[model samples]
Target: MKKAWIIWLASTLLLAAALHVAFMFAYPYILMNAAMDRLSANGERENVWTHAPRMTETARLIVRPSPDLAYSSCVYDLSDGPVQISVQPWGDYMSLSLFGANTDNYFTLNDRRMPESGAIVILRTADQAITDEQRAAAFEVVDSPSARGIALVRRLAPSPERFAEAEAARVQEECRALNAE
Candidate 1:
């Protein structure tokens, strides 16, 4: 039971040294289904529910938008649900997030510096060992993921335009204050 509620933070050292000769966006049905069903079953009717479970992997389901989550889009909200998915803000590298209730352990896709409240995204690289295009988003710089896999977007942030706006406002406010004063 304890194993089903653990989340670990990966180190950046190993993440940087690792070479991505091939990249792929294979959304393991297990991770998505398991997280959805478990969360819905435990949450209110507004949330999504699932019956199937995820495959095996030494992974951690990272990424979230606070613990008030109750829905499932392209990505899973790690705060609630049966398993605890620890999410950090994405600074430089993109990642893939996986969630499983059986071994209920959430972590990054073999990396560190996870996003704080957004989709676990990845960009196109020379990683031939991987094959999921949706994982790579070198083209669709506006959407969630690349091609094959679904890019997780923040529900709080509306679609079709800029991502963060409050920051811009803050900057503008500062400028105005400086000029007026």
Candidate 2:
């Protein structure tokens, strides 16, 4: 029955299309969530760096990471309010990127953006409002959309000989939750 075969083929094609569309929309979010879960559960928790020296070895928190770049990640929880981030411009190429739960990069900073002093400080918060005193003290205030997120630090280590220097720089980066005033 050609008619019945045609109906089945069309229905199957439609179902496949629908499934594909759904997966396409949901894949990024799902991937981000899974990465966050592994990151938070890996005992690093919030405000501490989880170093991944060999990026070729597939990390639980990042997909298709590059070995040429050394990585350090910190999960930030804004439930208690603001957090302090400090970076020492110890290398030629270094970057810090903040990503929210929805996989949006809300803020990013690099060595080139740092002051001549070769150090940078950031006050990050998800609070909708801030007092004048707080604003005055903030060197670089970042207003985030979500209460929880991750901060990633990337340092270029093109070869094994350069890895130690990059690792030293990565270790110098500081991320800590500030005590509420």
Best by lDDT: 2
Which structure among the candidates has the greatest TM-score?
A: 2
Report the Cα lDDT for residue 116, model 1.
Answer: 43
- 1-181, model 1: which lDDT tens digit per residue? 5544432223444454453322222244445445444444433321121211121243224443332221122323222211112223333333433333322333234224333443323222222222345336221212212111222222222322222332221122100010111
Clashing pairs in 2: none
Given candidate 1, what's the lDDT at residue 117? 47
Query: The CA-based lDDT of model 2 is what?
Result: 0.73
lDDT score for residue 144 of model 1: 15
lDDT of 2 at 55: 69
TM-score of 2: 0.74
